[model samples]
Every structure is written in C-alpha cells, then in structure tokens.
Target: MFAQVRHQLCPDLAIDLGTHQTRVAVGGRGLILDEPSVVAVDSESRRILGGGAAVGRVAKQMIGRTPDGITAAYPIRGSVVHDFDLCEAMLGSFLRKTGRSKLGLKPRVLMTVPGAISPVERRAVTNAAERAGAGDVFLIEQSRAAAVGAGLPISEPIANWICQIGAGTTDIAVLSLGDIVVRRARRVAGEAFDEAIAAYLRREYSLKVGSRTAERIKHEIGSADPLDEELVVEVSGIDTAGAVPRKAVITSEDVREAIAPVLQIMTEELRATVESCDPELAADLADVGLVLSGGGAQLRRLPEYFERQLGVPVRLVDDPARVVIRGTALCVDHFRQWRPYFESAA
Candidate 1:
C-alpha cells in the first residue's frame, strides 16, 4: 500500500551516469537534468563543497582552477563508480536539484551500466544510488538501453545494432528478441581522444595541454575523416621546455592523426563483435545497419567514417547524448513490463 501511494506521488527515476556527463529522467516526464559528472570537494576533509552540492557544471568549471584546499574531479570513470562517496554526493545533489527528494519516500531509480563492468562494480553503482536517496534501484545494460532509446525494434525478431561511444567507455551491442545477441565494451573513448590530442600537442608543438582544452580543440577542429578544406583552430597551452604559455594553430587532420590509435582499437573491437554474432544476425546487420549514440557519437563525420570503413550503414540517433537516459526513462514508465529486461538494482 505504501509503495503504491509513494509511486503515485513520486515517479520512478532513470539515470545515465557517464564518465564525462550525467543525465537524469523521471517517469512520465522527459529529461530533467544533464550536466558534467564532476564534483568539487575540500581536498583535506574530502567533503563536497557548496554545502555538499557542488556537482555537475559548477564543479566541472572548478577543474584545473581549484585552490589548494579544494579539488574538482570526476567521481565516475569508464561508466563505473571510482569514488563511491563522491558519486553518492554528486547524485544526491542532482536529485535535490531536480526536486527528487521526498520527505521519507526515496524515488526508485533505474540506472544504465556499461556492458563490461564486473559484478562488484555494478554493486558500487547500486550502492551509490541508494546512498543518494534512491529506493529499489534497478540496473539496465547500457547498449540495451541505447537500443531502446533509439527506438529500435529490439522486441521484433530482426537484429538491431547499437554503438554508444561514451566518455570513458564505448558499448556496442546487437539486439534481437529483446535481448543482447552480441556486445562489446572498450575503455578507450572520448577521454582517450582528448589524451591523444594533448599528447600530439606535446609531441609536435612542445605544448602541454589539459583535458578540457583538448576537448575544446576536438570540438572545434577534430574529425573522423578529412574535411573538404582542412579546418584549423588556435589553441593555447604551456610550452613544455619554457613552462610559459603559448598558442598554436592545429588542424582537424592533426587531431585525426593523433587519435588514430584509439579509433582503430574501437573499430577493430566493433568488427570483432559483429563477427562473433550468430551468422544470421550478422547478416541481418546488413539490413539493420548500426545506430550511433552517446557523447562520442558527436564526433564530426563519424557516421560516414564508420560506413566507409566497415561497409555497413551507420547513422546517429536523435539526441544521441541522452539515448541511455531516455531508455532508462522508458523503463521507468513501463516498469512492470520492462522489469524483466534488466537486472534488479538491489
């Protein structure tokens, strides 16, 4: 009775806890929160700043600019909770900010997890959400959620392929009859690309750059393929030898060259995953193609690049970044029916 009453008053919640960003959704409502999955805390005391609410965009902005007493960092890595306390604090703040706190009734949450996480890592996610004031947490695999969010006909007999290139990890899956037929997960993703850019700058220009700056450069000039005309952008960083600030112009081709290794790993793994699938399903992928979602899917010319190299059509889904969260929301809205589709978050 109490469960029913609480369900009536407060809707079920869904969360996509990506390494680079976190997104939240409520049943019967669309996306309610989207922000960088960052937290700022007192370095010595290990307490979240801003009255225990310094999370998301506010904390992300503090990265590389914090004082000696404070540190801003990501609580999650590769879609797994690296710092349980910080993850709880960050989720708590998002919950509060989105008006999810109930006086005594915690909201039930369904969180998406990467395909390759261990059981222990999965438990950490459940524990973090519970500690963050969630009740009856549920877990859905990330690729499965992305397929759902992309509105794939996974419930049908045909195969559907989904590739979610997130910040810390990339998950690819082939779904058929509402289940994963084959899947792959890799740790090298957006952050790896950023690292590659930084490394290239340091190697080629003697400029040492930070992740944020590298990300900006990637957004401005990075591409999966050569552009019609080479795109160049001005970037600033500290010179390695002089330890002085310097600026340099970089091109999209440079970024592509820098991140080639990481991209190659991802592409190889994707192909291997497809080859490992059932022959029938692998053949079906020719018709279904591949659906790209997640933050990394925004890389310029990514779809075209994949299609060209893999010999399979690739397309980005609408609102690619929110695909997992949207899938979680869909699960929350039809909890009874979808409950069987995911592992219980307990």
Candidate 2:
C-alpha cells in the first residue's frame, strides 16, 4: 500500500546524461527535455547563476563569452560526471524546467552510460542524480539502450547490431537474447572530429579556429566519402601567421580529409566488433545489417560510408539524436519488467 501511494506521488524519469547534451523523458511519456549539458556559475561564489536558469541552452550560448565572474562549462564529460555538485545543480535545474516536482518527494531516475564505464564512474552518476532529487537511480548501458531505441529485436534469438556515435564516445555492439554478444567503445568520436578539423585548418591553412567553428565546418561539409556535388563553407578563424582574424573558404574535400583519420579508426573498431561476433550471430547480421544512432549518425552519406566499408547495409535510425533517451524512457516505463537489464546500482 505504501509503495502504491509513493508511485502515485512521484513519476519515474529516464535521462540520457551525455557529454555534450542531456535528454530527459517522463516514465510513460516521450522525451520532454533536450539541452546542452552546460552550467554557468559565479566565479567567486561558485554558485549557479540565474537562480538555476543559467543552464542547458542558455549556458551553452555563454561558452567562450562569459563575463568576468561567470563561467559556462559542461559538468559531465564522456558520459561521466566530472563535477558532482555542478552536475547535480545542472540536473536539478533541468528537472525543474521540465516540470519535475519541486516537492520533498523524489522520483526514480534511470540514466544511460557507456558500456565500458568503470564501477566508480557509474556510482558517481547515481550519486549526482540522487543529489539532484532522484530516488532509486537506475543505470543502463548505452549500446543496449540504443538497440532498444532503434527498435531492434534484442529479445529475439537473432543478432541486432547497433553503432551509437555520440559527442564523446562511439559504442558498437551486437545483441542477442536481450544481451550484448560483442561490444567495443572508444573515446574518439564527434569531439575528436572537431579537434581534427581545427588541427587541419591550423596546419594546412594557417588558420586557428575555435571548437564551435570547427563543429560548424563539420556539419556543413564533413563527409567520409566524396559526394557527386561537392560542398563548401566560409570559416572564420585567427590567422596563425599574422595574429589577425580572417576567414577561409573550406571545401567538403578539406573537411573529409580532416576527419578521415578518425573515421578510419571508427571503421576499424566497428569491423573488429562485427568480426568478433559468434558464428550464428555473424550469419544473422548478414540479414539484419547495421543500425546507426546518435547525433554523429546524422552526418550526410554516413550510411553509405559504413555500408561500403562494412560490406553490410547500414540504415540510419529515425530521429537519431533522441534514440537513447527514448529507449531510457522505455526502461523507466517498464521498470519492473526491465529490471534485469539495469546494472546493479548497489
């Protein structure tokens, strides 16, 4: 009777606590919050600014342009909590903004993290959520969650392959019987691409660009393979040789060349993951192919690039950015039924 009463008072929440963004959803509802995982704090007081409104999108825009006493930054990196208090504050602020209760009672929260995160890292995530007014923190491996979000039949006997590329890491896995058969994760992902682009411009064009500029270049023209009609974008950066600000015209070929190394690394890792699958599952993959999820999967021609390299048809999932959050919501909606998949939050 007490449990029933508590359930009525608090709704469960599922969150994708990502390196660059945080996505949240109510237990039975779909996604409700999607924001950059950023926070702005007063430098001297070390307190959250704007009465908790200086978070998410607002804080993200303040990056690289904060005032003297304000600092805007991400509290989480690579799906791991770096600053516990700030993470809590950021989560709490987002929860409040998304209409989670401000009352004494706390809600059960389920969150997703990379498959290879350490036990201590997992504990940190739970602790941050608890501090942010969550009860009964639950953890789910990102690859599994992506599989569920991609609508793969993980409970069936056939193998379901998923490649989830996020800002900080890429998780590739094969699932069968609702469990991972083979998996590989690497810290090299979207951020790495951004850095590579920045480095390439500095090296080849003598232009120094900020992180955001590099990212824009990537989104505008970055590609794995050549396109029939090439693309180009104007980029603003500091003139490395002259110490002056300038703009340069960057072509799709330039972006492709810049990111080729990291894309090659991703391809090799994905190939190794697929090769390591069991014989039966390997055969199943021939029919099931591969499903790509996450923000990185939105890159144009990504599916074709993977299909050519992996020798298997690769289909990008719809709404790739919200796949994990949707899957996390499923876990929250059917918590009791999916409890076995939750990592022991001991």
**RMSD (Å) per prediction:** 1.7, 1.7
Residue ranges of candidate 2 with Cα displaced over 4 Å:
43-46, 62-69, 100-103
Give per-model TM-scores: 0.95, 0.95
lDDT per residue for candidate 1 within 256-306, as digits (tens), equals 999888888988988987889888989999877989999888999999889
Worst 10 residues of 2 by lDDT: 96-105
lDDT (Cα, 0-100) at 16 in candidate 1: 91
RMSD of 2: 1.7
Local accuracy of candidate 2 as per-residue lDDT tens digits, 252-278: 999988888999999999889868987
In model 1, which regions exceed 4 Å deviation? 1-4, 61-68, 100-103
